[model samples]
Target: MYLDYFPYPSLRLHQDRMLDAVYDTVSSGDHGIIMIDAPTGTGKTSSISAALAARPGKIVVAVRTVSQIDIYIDEISRIWSKTRHKPEIAYMVGKQKICPLEREFRGESVYAGCARLREWSRNYVSSRIAKGSSSIYDPASDSMPEEEPGYRTFCPHYLKSREGFELNGAVHFRRSGRALDVVESLKKRPISPSQLAESCQGICPYEIMSLYAKDADIVIMNYSHLFSPDFQDIIFQWLEMDSEKVTLIIDEAHNLGDAVRDMNSRILSMRMIDLAETEVEKFEGTLGQARLDESRERASWRREGIRIIRLLLPRLKKFLESKQQRMAEGEALLDADLFRSFIYADLDDIEEALSNFSDVAVAVADLNLAEGDRENLQGEIQPSLALVLLFLNDIERAEKDDSYQSKIAVSGSGGKRQARLEVNNIDPAANIRRITDNINATIMLSGTFSPLEAYELYLLGVENRAKKLSLPNPFPRENRLILGTRKATTQLEVREDADNREEISGHIRSLIE
Candidate 1:
């Protein structure tokens, strides 16, 4: 196979084994995990593709990012171009993640794309306006400018073509133009599509994996899709394909824990709760018309719940703030597991109050109120309340299911904090054993299943244990020196040093010189 299509030159032994294991599992009618623990520089992609030749149904080689996807696609296309066995390949990502221009040009809804483009354009225009530039309002309606339109204004096909597109026909240039020109134009006008795809909910990165998990021979996607409870359900649905036919290969496995945590966590900031309260309060004073008798006690409960949320928000903020401080000072005061507990606790409290508030809000909505009081409603509060209720419901479902675990946490830096969660309660060992019991044969491989024993530790309790094998690096060992550095700067210290502008500048100068 012409594997040189890979951006990297050669495949590593572990990658080869993983690919071989994929084929072996399919042939033997069993499923297994291939733990690839290799440092960077191993040609994992080449090895995976090479091994897939033995047994191929629908092949999906999932990776973390689109760039990685691109590299894989390019390599696969090149190899399949020369090989006899070629599977149909299609690339899909989340609707929001893909370029709006591509979506619209491809006949997908411009609503999301347009919304995003408009938001971007608004920011750009607002920024320009702040800098005292009104030229943003001025457009060259007479002719297409030599300069390409901004991404928000540009059409997907135009951007993809790289030769740029024109504002064809009679284009109405807005005095205070919306950010997304394509969306704005489509709003006032319409375009004829060259062709149409099957339903256009406009797939996103995660949705594609969910939709095609079972049918696609070589599935490609993020680790989050397979490991996260919220996402994994979608993947697991597809993994039901005879158990033995599917292989889960995680790239950048080091980040798997963080990804899982993110998929499981939920964060409803104090601002969100405050906004909900403000909106819900619009129904106040009109309780006479509200159908539910607003007893002093019920009103008190609603008021108290709002108060509790207000009080609770500050604590959550304080907790997050303290963690931020500790992080800034370069300390390990918090971890993924601990932060998860905090989120769960906060959600529990929020759910209690929010549910009470929602009941009150619904009661108020049921009551006849003045148009002004009703109009005082905020847009996001109702949805926020509903979303919180939905999350709580999902939590309850997982709690009883016995198949999933819920892990939530507060994580990240000062300005960039994240509330995260991950659910994976099902024992992988039992999972493997059950599948093996059904299928009766298995093989696991990877170029980076290093130290070999580590994989054993990971898959120790797994059922129908397969024979273990270790291959050389498949390249000259002397040609590469594996340097283990002990003095690597800690993540916290690096973050701190990065915050100091002068020090960063000095470091840059030293490096440049």
Candidate 2:
């Protein structure tokens, strides 16, 4: 039924079966999760054609990396050109990549700087609209207003994007303006994030792409776009569609488990602690020079908070050092209780102390952005204090959960030795389910899902509910070679034996010859 949407004039071997499996699972009334293990030559991208043909609501194809997005774009372009079936398509990349001010910010400060600029731009545009002036600020013709005394800078692209939009309560785009024209143009073709960023010379690329994604039939995004809770919220809000109405297609699904675990894990390193100390000291040095009485009071409170954090950092470092001394140059399970007790011992009220430190961290981040310090902007600035708080918070949350394992890893040797606290996620099933359970239907495609049952049960946690399809190799037997041997074994126990090593080496040599 969906063959009309397929790009090619004819389907390759086993392609129809793969496409039928996707169609059946998605078009079914109930929510479904299907894992497809299509071999390398099976034309896996065509699964997108099957999804489109299903007419599933708002198909979202999430790839492992930004580079992988191009494959889908090429396939969709083919569908449009050959079949004349043009579905509205939009793709998103991380803000850091598409931010117009990326060159100006120079480092990890770009995100903080972007946030600061957007806040300023929103306030500036609001004031202008209130004063009966044009909300849109033209960069080419109109000179930018001087920066407000306290504010460092404004983003003209962001300001321009605010045009014809109601921001009083909920953001509602006005349909009868140049914004509509831009949306229509974007819908005409699948534009990559870089091309979108370039075409949006005066408007915010992120904002425009988000707007395009809202009405798009298909949105291509990164894995983080769906798995990271914070980003997931933003993308869902932009789509303006219920999760139950969204059909998710995860490309290269083999990476999902690792990606989810990495997302859930928290790491606290000595380098982070040192940077947090620098931020606190720098912010504290500027405290007494502030103006208003209210401002002074706030500064005084922030100073007290930083003082507590300053005292806490050394203790935390000592804890990590002590753990390092106990372990060899490798990882060992950590006692969450021991770490928790150490933290509690330092503060009378653990929650209050954490809250104070969090407030101070925010203030320091703002101060650093305002100052635009050359040293701070040179690298990604993760407030070490924040990392400490997050690690502690994760430990608290994982107290009863066996899926999370707290560990300390010692790396390098003697003088160069480094130890870090980690709350590792051993099982990503719960996290993955949180997503798959809510969506209408999910179709996961990968070339490496050989033990498909393992992914169905462990990684996705969709055991009984999921549909599994493993397509045979499309290439003919004579055209390809497959070989195996039991003579050489690389098992840890026997691999080091002289005969075993020589046999393994001989196998490799024979294959090469």
Candidate 3:
């Protein structure tokens, strides 16, 4: 059965065993987790053949990097050409990579800029429809007014992409024939994000990939698309599929633990505080003009909120400076309560102050965007104040959770010294299990999961529910060479020493000779 979808006419040694294990685990649905520890020559990408043979629904493959995405795309394309088994395939990267407006929206996050442009596009279309001037499908409906600032206010690509789709009250796309044609063209072959962006001249490449993914049998994406909860929610919603119905494949499973830890961590730096202070000062000058239509009482409250942020900035800088003086050039544990107390000493209610700060940060960001001065919008687009709030919020959330550790690290030399506050996640099992427990089945592939029990029990938290398969190197003993050295040590403490370095170089020289 697996051979039906397998791209090559033959499988490598032990490749059949790996394929059968995946097939049985997926088909039986008794065990929802499987770990494949196959060495370099094992033909691991062919595991998709077994997955497709067993499951009839969508398969979401998570890769560690952008380059890994091409292997799957190439394999699937080969499958289509060789076996005549064509499964619709699609891939997505972060919006920041494919968004055309990223350069125009300077310091703004692609996410925020995309949202604003989409809103403007929708409003423009709705207004045109209301006046009976054009329908959603009309080409002219996507055109900007002769007198209006088109690119500044709305994205032409976004408007053109949505020409054939009417958004329901729930925001689901009710696509027409034109939209279907676009999706069909995308399915003619598997395209990388860069290729997709290049081909999509006047339309939003992200949206086009999204539209195709809704109907794709297999979708390839980065690790964050599945591991990060926010990205997971957006991707699943865009695909219009439930977690229970989707089968997930994690490529390079060995790196998952570190990836999860990185995703949950947050950082705040002295430089961010300095930029935020500048943002607040500029925002205060424009507050009067920005809030003219608001009630006097509300405007006064906004002003007070701005003042609080301005005062807090210097205090934050001072705190970091003090910590820098006491600590060496390394990291030290920070007491969450002590940090909170020091930062919030002037506020009567800590929660309310945080809430007010969040509100002011968002207001300042929106005001900066509304001013129509992209050149001066430096950090206002992403708003360092918002980042500060996020860092503090994470510290608060992890206060009682032992799985998280808060630390302050001082780096660089005397004149270039910089201090940063960070909240690090020590355990990744909980986050990993969060996704594994929801999906129909999870197949983790890696070339380095040696001592398989470590990954099965500890890293993946799938001890009882997982079927483990470890394959030996596929190449013959006579065809390969392996060598090692015990004379040289690359340990951090001694690796930089002159004798140790010379010893390592000597070994390399002997090998070359």
Candidate 4:
């Protein structure tokens, strides 16, 4: 059915199977999870795109990295070109990656500096709109540049796009009096990030791309776009769209568990504590803080910061001094059962301590929000504090879920190190449900998503309504050589042993020869 729209010369057996799965899922109008295993060399990308092109509603291909976005943009361009009906396509990336205003601050941290600039831009635009100035973009305004002959001069989507993309056809540019369709040109030949950044001279590329994605036929984005809450407000909402139809393709899904964990994992360190203390000391002595009365809400947070520094910190410091080993030598795990034996007794007290430290982290972070220090927050303090808070919150939340296991570890020099807590969601399947639950059709694709049992149970949350599909190698294997030899073990401990290492090295040498 998709032959004309499918751009590939010929589909391999596995590729055809993938295409069928995607088409069938869409055809059945199913609303459940699908674990799709498509190994390399199967032309999986083309098959999936061609299949999805025929599906109704928006398609959000959530990939792992910016580089993956590049691949899809190219592939989507190739496959979509085959179809008589072209779908609007866009890629979503972080402002740090796409921000246009960040160019001026080349040497400094662009993301950190752009925060204020973005805020300023929003205010600038809003204020102009309020004053009814001509600078304010008016989509309905018939005022437009010269129209190109072939391109649609007036696409409804162009109105929402402030960058003059909503034109009689895609926004046209004149090169020596000849009108050129920018959007059509883009579909014909996709540009790299640098080129796109250059083309987006004035308008915020992030906003422009997001506007395009909000109405696009396909939106390719990073994993964080779905998993990170911050992106929900900015990017994911545009991608995780709903209609009578929806399909979410998690590419490179072999690392789904890791990606989820990375999204959920939080860590705190002694460095944060040190920074908190130093910031508190400096903040308390600052003239601005001194002028503020005790009635100020910030003063209370400042007191909490001081309390963490004066009281909570000493306990950690003492414990570090007591322990002979910390993260430097490796790590020492604190037993869960011994929770009471630690300095903090009841769970309430632990929560309170963690909460206080979290407050201190907040105070320190807010203190850095000062004009001079805002940019450094991203480059320095915020990361450590963010991890620390994530760690604490993870422990707190895991306490409520039996599926989670929490262990505390101590790292760094005893002189002034904080404890590191690691919380592993033993069953991330349950947590992953929250992310995939709403989608009508969820496609989890990976090269190594085998042992379908584990994947269905652990990755897909093993829903009764879910469909697990595994495709066979499409290519003939008669000419392929599958070689294996058991010689020396490469297990961690054994591999470190001198005799085992020598034996493994010998086997490697023999294999190479």
Runs of candidate 4 exceeding 4 Å displacement? 50-54, 94-110, 116-194, 202-204, 229-235, 238-240, 243-245, 275-328, 336-387, 409-419, 463-465, 483-513
lDDT of 3 by residue, 1-513 (tens): 989999887889999999998888777653388989999999999999999999847999998777788899889989889886898888876676788777776565566677677766666666666565333545334446543332467777677666533455212224334545777887787776668766665577777777777789998887777766435555677578777777888898988888888877877888778777777766766765667447778776576677578667778888899877877788998887788778888789878777878888788777653322121111124667777777778888788787788999999775777788999888888778877887778899999888889877666655666788999999999988887777798553576799999999998898889
Model 4 / residue 248 / CA error / Å: 0.7
Q: Which stretches of candidate 3 lie over 4 Å from their true place?
A: 95-156, 164-180, 274-311, 361-383, 483-513
**How far off is residue 346 in model 4, in Å?**
11
Against the correct fold, how does model 3 do in TM-score? 0.78
- In each prediction, how many residue pairs overlap at the backbone (N, C-alpha, C within less than 3 A)? 32, 0, 0, 14
Screening candidate 2 with a backbone cut-off below 3 angstroms (N, C-alpha, C), the clashing residue pairs are none
Best by TM-score: 3
Report the C-alpha lDDT of model 4 over 348-452, residue by residue, as the tens digit.
Answer: 566666676677566555655322222321222243444444654666577677776766665456475546556776666655666677655677788778876
Lowest-lDDT window of 10 residues in candidate 3? 371-380
| lDDT of model 4, residue 49 | 60
Q: Ten residues in a row with the worst lDDT in model 4?
A: 171-180
Error of 1 at 324 (Å): 11
Number of the top lDDT candidate: 3
The full ranking of all candidates by lDDT, starting with the best, is 3, 2, 4, 1
Candidate 3 accuracy as lDDT: 0.75
Distance from true location, Cα of 194 in model 3, Å? 4.7
Off by over 4 Å in 2: 100-109, 116-141, 144-156, 163-180, 274-311, 321-327, 346-386, 413-415, 482-513
Worst 10 residues of 2 by lDDT: 371-380
* Each model's lDDT: 0.42, 0.74, 0.75, 0.57
